[model samples]
Target chain A: MEYAYYPGCTLKQSAFPLDRQSRKVLRALGHGLTEIRDWNCCGATSASKLDDFLEVAMPARNIGIAESAGFEEMLIPCSACYSKTVVAKTRMNRDPRLKQEINSELAHQVRGEIRVSSILEPLFDAARSRELGQRVSRQLSGVVAACYYGCMLTRFPLDVDLRDDAENPGFMEAVLEAAGGTSLDWQEKTFCCGASATVYDRETALDLMGRIFSDALARGANCLVTLCPVCQMNMDAYQEAYCSRLGRSRRLPVLFITELVGLALGLGYKELYLDRHFVDPAPLLREMERQQETEAAS
Target chain B: MQEQTAFQVSGDAARELSAEIAGRSEQPIASCYQCRRCAAGCPVGEATGYLTPDRLIRMVLLGDRKMALNNDLVWRCLSCYTCGTRCPNGIHTSRVTETLKQMAREERLEPLHPKTDSFHRSFVKTSLFWGRMNEVGLMAAYQARVLWSCLKRRDFREMRSEISSQTRFGLSLFRLGRLHPGWTVSRGRRELGRLAAKSGRHSR
Candidate 1:
């Protein structure tokens, strides 16, 4: 199963580990990812906040490029990119005049036939087909994960349609279960992490992030796994700050779903890029490894 | 302790704002029946004073353009869309907030949250210049903007503290290879520039 991949700006820099792990995990599952040629930024919340034309034009250019590359479906890993691209495509396809206007702004023509899908879609599909289970050499039996789906992944039910229940999604839980990990039931699964607010309004963003961390810890989650880069960055990088601010000493490791899946497939820590996380996940991974060894001996 | 105050209908601003919001989002503001469900779901509504999702729509209906535009809540919105998704009338409060932010910039209203506004501008400008987000460039530009404002207000202590705190985080990200001072140009930059220029014209 080959698809045109769109790894947005965050994945290239701040979220590079996500890109590496995603590619590794997909290849391990016998799927191929081909990047969309000459893709630009998806013009996230910033572009849409500033100008309407830019919001539509930026994502339309990437979609047009994908269509021109002879691909009917493009895989986007970042939730923000997926949401922005899907929203742009839906609006453009619905309005002929808007479509024409956007096309005039772009070098390539948007055929409006291409579909944009999240990386989770293919992984979930593989799980349903039992290919994922077949490839898992190591079962993450002892790892309890709180699957966090930030706003963009399932925000617009009518527009994106990525999940059945946008408010209370179980897609990630299913994928985690297939990987042999226990998915914890938590209320903050779909809560907002205040996203870019981390940069602008640190206090408020930290407050929001702290709430998520506290909830996951209270629910017996050893670590938090997420599909969105922004959520991962906020929860992982700011854990210390949140803990210190709240006078708490507990730390929770946040992992991308791809990394967690890669580990279950017997991929090494170095291969999964686990060391690069802000809050080290090494201690938790070692604990898991120790448990696996003892259980195997028993 | 409560006094009855009647707000006289101002000519056209409220009506124009409501019409423009309807035109952009395609949701009828009149259908909002003050259920406060949107506010209930909003994460930042309480934190943001006087601009809850329901109240924002109510203000728009009342044609209180000054109050809606002047409030800091417009800029503080996280655009999470929780309120919008849960709206019984299907009115997207997040989209309405976006429209309000754009209008506020056009009307040259002062942002209640200056740092957020600066970051938003820095993000777009960096995208426009580099065809991708240059994290280091964005922080540098944002710091310059903040420093200039601080100097203008004669707040030297704030300027120093802001620079130091930002530098601390920037250094960490840089050491982690998550940020670079130089440009990170993507393919088809020239085409992106052309498209951006054309879109700017259309937006104007």
Candidate 2:
């Protein structure tokens, strides 16, 4: 099946791996994804919180562009973008005035039907993913993964049904299992990493990150896997502040969901978007290499 | 960081809040074993001194009402559900905390700590009245609430202390320039009010 794709700004830039790996996995799984040619930014977090109309129209513009590109169901990998697009879709469907207002602002002009979905749900769609899970060449049995679903992914009323459970999501578990990893059934899975606040409030941000990381460590998780780019950046880049404030350096590797899936599919680490990560995955990289050497010797 | 306060909670309201507000499962509140996992996982609990999901449950089991509502712990929860995600018994601790906040609001009980609730409320109230949230109108309405509440208690001094120098500095940042003209808060409220009323009609 062909799915229209939106790689909102981050996935094209800092989180390019999410876009790259998503395409790789979708192609390998025998699904076709056609990206809208001239998609604009979904206004990320700032636009939605700043104004209601801009939030709806900004995302609707992409939906309009995607519709114009000849597709119905679109996949968004970034959690914020997923939230923005889905939330806007809900507004357009529920409120006619809002729809009329937002549609008027579009350039390419789309007055058609569109459905937006996060990469998580489509990955969890059993009919589409069972074969993909069976194709996993490597069994990450020892890899203990913690799934983090930061805010906006599930909180906003309009974007509520993106996961199995909005409050206590299990999309990570489904994706992790497909990638052959042992996931911790821990409570910190749905916690927020203080996403937008990290820009202006370091103290609060570090404190929030510290709490989540420490909890994951306590649960014996080896690495934290997140679907959102900002969540990955916060967990990966903020280790220094976490060390300074908490008085202990704790480095927990954060991997994008696509990167993890690619690894399970026996794809090279380089292609999995490993290099773009802020917290060097050198330790995990070395560990993966060591495992490979052992298998080769055997 | 502020020193942790000694707050006491009654087991009944804690359990009741869990049942009525937080929408905890109808099973049993006593099932929780104080694993401390809930508190450890909570996002808001990590930032604020007052909140802890584990302790809130303990308060309910022990029948600690004053501790639950008066300590300002209820407001600290971001309702993100990190605790419930891992809860073995599936108790929704976050929902329970929210119920406590709603109860506190209805009772006109003083909030345990200073918060942006007044600001958010003014935003909501203005939207209810005008179909949009005017930033200038919201700020002014919030100030009026602060002034009115202070006058009711005849304790403007206490109110003055609540608005710390740091908070004032933060407030100044919003005033640097016109940020928002208006918002759909008013429109949202109208729809929400209709839904609420319709739900009420159905239940009755």
Candidate 3:
């Protein structure tokens, strides 16, 4: 299967491993990600603050580009992009006047026609069908991860029908488990990771991250498996800030669900950019793989 | 400034804010039953003093426009939609808070959290220009705005700390390839500019 892909700016610029690994993992599962031609930013939360029309217009414009490129739907991996575009698409669908106004202003076809989906949808389906299990070259037996959803994927009060439950989403774990990994049931799965609040107030963002780290660590989760680039970036980049606050050093590397899937498919650290994280995931994965080897030998 | 009088007095003025919020953001500020579910679930409840989702709505409902537009919640809202997820009525408080933030700006009230204002401005401006945000460009632009703000206020101490903290964070990001520096403008830049004009974008 091939879907029109929107890597978003973050995935291309900041969250590099997420985009690369997701594409590779999907390829291993016999799928393709075709980048949307000349896509703009989804405007994230920033545009929404400035003006309502700008908020919807930015994402709606990207959808228009995707639709014009002959795609019925586009796959966005970045949670922030996914949520912004999803909400805008939903609002545009319900408000004909607003849709027509934006369409005419931007010279888009203005019909809210194309569908939008997060990349997780297909991964979850592949896992459920046991295709993921069949394709897994290396079972992540000892890799225990707390499946984190952040906020964007959790609640869609609008008409965008998502696969997982709002409160306790299971798709991340299911995908990991299918790849022979252990999923730790955690309470802070849907907790906020402070989002763009990180830019203005690092303290608030880090504090929220601390709470998430505390919970996951207390639950014996070796690492956090997340789909949202913001959650992954916060937990990975600012981990030192988290540890220094506690007056002790501990590193709980946050891994993207896609990267984990790539690992299960026997992809290397270089391929996943595992060395690029602040809190290195290489040592942890090595240890887990050794454990798996030992269990198999015994 | 029909809405300005409501901020100063009470009665019909207070009621107008509620209606204005409804008309502007199209959020149902009136449907709040004060179940406190939103408050309990709010991720920033501990961080914010008295700006729980329910209380924020209450401020608008009571026509406390001054407080509503300039509160901690309005400036610091994560827009994570945790409140909306838990709300019985499905009222997304983030949208209400966003509407309040824009309201504060149009009134030219000094933002209570000036750094957040800087972030919003930098983010929108670059995103509008490049059609996407470059991590390095966004941060540099934000710091420049913040430092400029501090320079005007003659807050030398804040300028020093801001520089040091940002440098440290930037160094760390650079090491991780998180600060990958490149930009690609959308092909429809012309259309985007027209959209901004039609939407009344606050800045160029």
Candidate 4:
């Protein structure tokens, strides 16, 4: 299967691991991704707040670019980007005036038509059931993970509908099942990590993150897994900051869904971008390794 | 501004907003039992003081237009629908809040919160003009309102790196070269005028 992929801005920079692991997982699933030509930002947090028309046009430009690439569906991994693009498409499709205005403004830069979807949607669609069956190597027995959808993935459910149940979502449980891991029943999975506020308001962001982490840990989750890079970054990076600010020793490993999928696939640990994490996954890795060896000897 | 003390909404407007809400939501607002779940789950309310979903609903149910318009909670909502999903009674608190905001803005009873109107206006202007947000512009505007030092020192490097990377990915603020050529101040005025005209013609 071939797909048009829009990796977004974050995947290339600080959250490079998500991009690397996502591609690897898709490749292993026999899908090839052709990057959309001259794709632009989805105008999520800042853009949406700035100019409504620009928000639609910005993602529309990239969508048009992807459509021109001869791809019907565009796979986006970042939740923020996914929300923005899907929202833009929905708005443009609904508003003729908006469609004309944005198209007129971006007549030069844009090409083709794009139908945007989150990376999770296609993964859930194409490979989920089969990927579950292929899990013979290692089963993450007894490991409990909190599957975090964060806010972006579920926020605009009407537009994107990527989330299974907007009210009480647990689709991640099925994905986690493929890795032989049991996802915990946690309330904080759908909460916001204060995505863009990490820069402007560290205190509020930390308070929100701390609440999420504490709730998940209290429920006995070994780690938190999410699809959005911002969520992963905030959950991991802010753990240290929160620990320092509050005077405590705190460590909770944050894993992108692809990283967990990579682990289940028995791919090399470093290849999954495990090294880039601020909080080490070594303890969890060693424990999993030890468990695997014990099972082998037994 | 003496009229700004509060635009006392009548039973007619509250009933109208509630009826409009019911038409869209298919859920009754009067069923709300004052369970603070809506306020409890709100992400924006965690920061903005006293902007509770329950209180807004209370105002609507009681037809206390002045109370509803005066509260900052009416417009502070991010419309994430956390409250609606969490509400056992199926009350659409966000919709009620939105109608309140529209009514409040119309009656010139905008809450005297710091920079709230400016923030909303700037956000809408950015979206309407460029069809996306200009993050740099938003950051500059927000920072100007909150104070420069709140941004912290040495954060520019990080912000710059982020900006450059987004530009490479085609999410640049500079890309919004101009608003749609037809989107002039007069066009907006015309649209608003048309809306007011339509509403006026229909009201009779």
Best by TM-score: 3
What is candidate 3's lDDT per residue for B1-204, written digit by digit as tens?
012322344888678999999778777879999999989988888878666889888878888877888878788788877788778887888889888888889899998998998898899888887777888788889999999999999999999999998898888888777777666567766677788888874653
* Interface DockQ per candidate: 0.58, 0.06, 0.67, 0.09
Interface RMSD of 3: 1.7
Q: Rank the candidates by TM-score, best first.
A: 3, 1, 4, 2
List candidate 4 segments past 4 Å from native: A108-115, A135-142, A157-163, A243-248, B1-37, B44-49, B54-79, B84-204
* Per-residue C-alpha lDDT of model 1 across residues A1-298, encoded as one tens digit per residue: 7788999888887888889888988898888889988788888888878777778777888999989989879999999999999988988887888889778766779988887899898889878888888889998877899999989988862355455488898888888889888999898888899999988888888888888888999999999999999999889878889899989897888999999899988899887878887888888888888888998999
Model 1: CAPRI class: medium
Report residue A220 deviation for candidate 2 (angstroms).
1.0
Better of 1 and 2 by TM-score: 1
Ranking by DockQ: 3, 1, 4, 2
lDDT of 1 by residue, B102-172 (tens): 88788788877888888888887777777777777777888888899999999999998898888887777
User: How much is the lDDT of residue A175 in candidate 3?
Assistant: 93
For model 1, the superposed segments whose C-alpha errors exceed 4 Å read B1-8, B11-13, B180-182, B201-204
Q: lDDT scores for all predictions?
A: 0.82, 0.64, 0.84, 0.64
lDDT tens readout by residue for model 4, B1-204: 122333356777778666755553345787888879888888877665554777667666656656765565654555556787778887756555555555555566635543444555554444334333344454445445444322454466655654554344233212322111222121222232232233331111
- Tens digits of per-residue lDDT for model 3, A1-298: 7788999988887788888998998899998778977888888878888888888888988888777778877888898899888988899999999888888866546567778888888899999999999999889988989999998886763546777898889988989999989989888999998887777788998889889998898899988989899888888777888768966466788999998899899899898888888888877888887998898899
Give per-model TM-scores.
Answer: 0.95, 0.61, 0.96, 0.70
RMSD of 3: 2.9
- Residue pair clashes in candidate 1: B14-B63
Model 1: residue B76 alpha-carbon error in angstroms: 0.9
